[model samples]
Target: MKKSLNELKELAKICRGDIIKMTTVAKSGHPGGSMSSIDMYLSVFNLANIDPKNPYDYKRDRVVISHGHTSPGVYSALSRLGFLNPDEVIAGFRHSGSIFEGHITRGIPGIEWTTGNLGQGLSAGVGMALASKITGNNYHVFVLHSDGEAPKGQIAEARRTAKKENLNNLTVLVDYNDIQISGRARDVLYVDLFKEYESAGWNIIEVDGHDFEQLFNAIEEAKNYKLGPTVIIAKTIIGKGVSFMENRHEYHGAPLNDVEADKALKELGVENDIEKYKEMRKTLPLLRKKLEFDDYVITADAGTPITYTKEDKVDNRGAFGNAIADLAKINKGKIVAVDCDLKPSVKLGKFEKVSPETYVQIGIQEHNAATIAGAMSVCGVIPFFADFGVFGLDETFNQQRLNDINHTNLKTAVTHCGIDIGEDGKTHHEINYIGIVRSFFDTKLIVPADPNQTDRAVRYAASTLGNVVIAMGRSKIPVILDENGNPYFGETYEFEYGKMDILRKGEKLTILTHGSVAYKAVKVADKLKKEGINISVINVSAPLEFDASRISEYIDNSHIIIYEDHNKYNGLMVEFSKSVVENRLSPLSVENLGIDNYSPSGNNENLFKIFGLDEDSLYEKIKEKINK
Candidate 1:
């Protein structure tokens, strides 16, 4: 139900008071921007088709606050509109124990996206808008950003994507307060926001942000515009309701002192209740009860797994392409693949051919594409972001981190990882992916050893929930074969995540490897066995997880060989050593055969030999260890 203009005016005053009280009580927050953005937040929350009781309703509109430092404004607006309790918000703002942190968080009622880092929210909105078209949910996405973030290149990238996708279901409300922490926005970095939006083919509207009638009318106009996404440039005053702090850059990030807050409250005719909230905050629990939001339900049908034989001579990327194409055919609208103009290289061309409508081509914009894929995953669509490891994991690392923070069900398939990428050199080789993903608590990483394993991993990732990364290299390696000369990851082999695949069992020593190096390890073991040195070889696809029990049986005098095409400091070798110590296993002299430094661009085979990771080098190293 839309509130009347007079009713909205009265509510805005209360919300303004709430914003002031919360910030003043917290003593650490951006009050100026919050005050400036409060009225617009109130107007949108009241007018949007959102139910406070059923805040996570699938049919409801999504609201993203890009400038999350203005959390006081968002919490106040949501509280005033019945989405949260005003008392809790005022008492818990910026409190360590509360869900109401300094920045806005998702899974909180009425907060669609957790956006403290600026300029990414628009891309998130574009993703949701694109998901609306894919899932036919038809829910509109409204992103409220600030003028301080107008100069970001990701915003420009998002604008182009929105226009290219013709996302008429998206609208952006920019709080053009023209004030940043340093000084005036124009002086900080002049960005002609209106002209930029106009150039991006967006319908533009200028309105007074504090005026209820003008804001309401502009929003209605934007909702009705059919050409493309709309941007409402709302002119706002910093410190809107308080005269003492109005238009002062000092108040942008600094909360007013107690005396100044009291004077400002008196000026706005709002009671100064900071002391009461301050006392209540001290009694607040360190950890609040978990807030309930709708859980992500996987709806896509993971098609039958594909098996590749030794004669297939296909790369892991090719197997991924086939698996995703198969998934797209079965899942149809439920699955989408996001590509960063590397369709041919990343092997998403097959997926594009199978389901062209579901394949998104975001040309050369990995940052924007990464964020879009993450946001799309949560909006009832299983999005797989396919790109080279350098772009997908290394270049867009922060975006991937944000996706992890959002707990998105994004399957990131990064091909051409490690030195197997060959001539692309150090710049293209992604050797630190294991370390990068280890930082995330919820995200899972899978390094498939062969085409057969890659196929199963892709299928497994599709059927699974949460964020999963299936990393592969750029070589046509042979399929991993069992002792009986059949495919190791064959028809009957299910892809159990975090389980090590012991390809060859022996007693002299154990060889642990994954990805492009797994087949080489098995061959090395065979050669050593021929020379009267029987050694076990294990492929650890999930390097992030350390299960000491899986390898306890193969610990031959604690003499293990850790060889991989990854950085020695953060790869499986480090993981194995940590697990060994943590699990209280007997210490043994281990030979770490991993990349110690970057190599020159050449054939992958030659590169391996240069780095002393080839089959012969590994065989000799193992023999020397056994002889010792």
Candidate 2:
């Protein structure tokens, strides 16, 4: 039997109580926003055609929480719906080893995407909706957003894209709960979200977020609409249930103590809350069944491999494109490539020729491309997005950050990384791609040394189950390993996260580098060897989380010279120094050879020489430092 409005409201109240109690016990979480959005959450979970028993089922509708700070509310609703055990929800908030983190995680069963970075969920939702349309699936994607976060530029960009594309399967719900972390949202950034969305070609609906019937009706209406996306502005009060906490900024992220918890429970007519919680646990299994776990597999038809000749020296970007085409031959149905109008330069045009239907030519919209990739990932497809490293990383860092938070498993192939992208000037050069991506723990940064490694990295990224940022260079590098050679080939060197590959062994100086700069280091080491200076060269591919223990033995035996195609401040220089210090490796004297300052417009040779990143410059630097 369908649940009545009163029953839904009662359930929403129960959820609010659970949220407050959980956050109070954890002593840290956003309570106000959670409380305000309880009714809206209850309405959707109750009315949407979502199956908890088959959470990953392809036919199931998707719900993306944009206002991720209100994780308490989402956890409460998911718990009440039986997606997780009530005890797990109560015991796991901000706890170590608990999947129920302060923010949403992909570990949670029913969550379509992990989110916390604001203003990104809508874009991701658009992608999911687009995927549904492309694949002929009849599922709707609903994105819940906070009012204050709507003013971000990406939000506008996403809205414009949705409108232009006529995405009717997408719906955006704005929790117009006046208050944010500081004060009223309007006071901080006045936004007529209803009018803004309407002007952008979205069908706007305003409703009392606390009203279950109204919210349910709006959702039903949205599903029936066939023109464009819908935006439901849900006007709600911050901290709706608790009298003292209502409409207050202080309660946004504070945990109530025992005494306050008692008072809050008393207001809800649940004087003996322990008994109530015990009884609710019995009904938790019903909610768990709604989270489905059916995995759908799509196979691609076989196609001829576009083999490259030995004489043709191509850039990593070109090799990545060819690799994508190879992937399309293997998994055509579930693999797609998106490019930001730089398809010709990024070499994604090759994939487009092979799989025209699977390639999306999103012109000059890196932000849109990322969200599209996120959406496609959610729909059981692998998306490789390509662009220049500077535009792809720095310009759309927030989009990728949110993708990581969402755990979208989107693979980004960023070309022209670091000062090696010469003559384009400093504005076009990307020397900080690794550092920026490394800052986020969820993202894996892969800097392949050569074309073969680039192919391997692309294939690995396509099959991996998390968000990835593959940094590639514009220049063509010589193949370091022979095609028949097996350098650590059989011994499980399969792109383990945080593991480094030792290319050459020597007892003198240790040359640590990655990407394009690592090649220069190898040349420099060979030059030094001719003059009786045998330097060990290590290709440290995984930048974010390096294996200190595996490389600790080598650090003590040699003086380390870290070379990179990036700035010295927060790039590889600092990372190497910190690693040595933390491991307490005999206080080794390390010399950093990298682009220490802004670069100028010049050829690749001039730029590398000026920054001391080329073989000649690096050789001189190492010689001078060692001689002294």
Candidate 3:
């Protein structure tokens, strides 16, 4: 039920009081911005097509709190509107024992995308808005941001994309309070926000943020506007309610003291019952039940796996393209392919042809693409962000990290990984992908050995939940063959994550390898076996995790060589060494035969030989180790 203008005005005052009390009790929060943004929050939440009872509905309107530091205002407005308990939000506001974190979290009631890192929220909102168009859902997306984060490049990228897509269901309510951590937002960054939005083709509406009626009307106009996305630049005063705190930059992030809070609450005409909540804060549990996000279980039909044989010489990127395009055909609009101006190189042209509506091309905007894909993943879309590994993983690491924090189900199919892209040189070679991906706790990395394995890995990543990176090289690789000259990752092979595949059996020394060099390891093992020096060759597709039992027999008290086209310091060698010690498997000697430093532009074979990772070089290294 929508509240009357008079009723909303009264509620805002109470919410203002709640904001002051909560932040003062917590002693750390951005109360000033919260106070400034409170009236707008109250209006939007009331006007939006959202229900406190059915907040988890996929079709519900998404309200992304981009400036998540204003949680006091968000929680207070939500509590007053029946989305949360007032007392819990006040007492548990930034306590280690409570879910009410300093930054707004997504699992909380009424929260959509959890955004604290400035500049990415708009991109996330754009993704959610695009999902509605692709799925034919009428739900709208609203992102509440601030002028303080206006100068960020990702925000500009998001604005252009929104306008380019003509997202009529998306609205951004920017809190133009003009104050930030240091001082005035204009003095800090000097971004002409209105001109920026105008140039980007957004429908702009300037309004008084403190006026409930004006905010409600602006939102109503945005909801009905059909040309493109709308941006309501709300002019507001920092610490709006209290006269002493008004326009003061010091109050931007720092909370008021207890005495000041009491005074502020008294001015707002709300009761000062802070003593009771302060006591309640102490009694809250250190650990509450974690919020479960199992609402979006993937139901798309992952089509039949395509197997490549010895006759088919293809790059892993080609295999990825075939698998993802097949998935798009089978799932239709449910599988979205996001490209960062690398559709041709990343092999997403087929996917675009099959599902044009779902293929989002965010040209040269990897940061925005990464966050946008992450947001779309939660909004009933299986988004696959395809790009070169350097751009997708290296340049957009921070965005990907934020995606991981949001626990988003994003599948990133990155090609041109490692030096296999060769002549592209050091800048293009993503030698640290394994290290970068390993840093994300919830993300899994799959480095497929050959074209056949790449196809299976892509499908597996699409079907799974959480973040997964399917890293592959640009060069075409031969199909890995078994003893009978048959494709090892053949027709019947079901890709089980974390399981090691032993391509060749031996006894002298064990060689562990993945992706760019897995086939080389097998060749070396076969050649050594021919010379009466048997050694085991294992393919570790999922480098981040593995089942110790699968490879324990080969490494127990035996010499081990970790060979790969990755940085030796933090690649598979580091992970394998930890497993050996943790699983109590004692290896006689472990050597790392991987890229120790960057190589110059040249053929991948020459680069491999230089880095001691080519077939012959690996064979010679194993021989030397065995001789010792």
Q: Please report how far candidate 1 places residue 355 from its true position, in Å.
A: 1.3
Q: Model 1 has how many clashing residue pairs?
A: 0
- lDDT digits (tens) for residues 234-292 of candidate 1: 99999998887889999899987788888877887887888889999999988887666
Model 2 TM-score?
0.82
Question: What lDDT score is found at residue 17 in candidate 2?
Answer: 82
In candidate 2, position 472 carries an lDDT of: 86
- Taken over the whole model, the C-alpha lDDT of each candidate is 0.89, 0.77, 0.90
Residue by residue across 1-628, what tens digits does model 2's lDDT show? 3467888877787887888777876778988999998888877776766766756768888888888888889888887876778777875566653567788765476677777877777878878887887677878888899998988877887898888778888888889998888899899888988778977889999999988888989999988898999999999999888899899988888877778888887887654354454343344332232223343433233233233334558677877888888888677556788888898889987798888877877677788678778668767677788889988889888878777755566888899988787888899888888679877877888887766567777877777777788998899876554223443322233555567877767775777888876766776776787888876788887766665567886788567787888777777776776777788775256777778788998898888888777787778777876776
The candidate that achieves the highest lDDT relative to the unseen native structure: 3
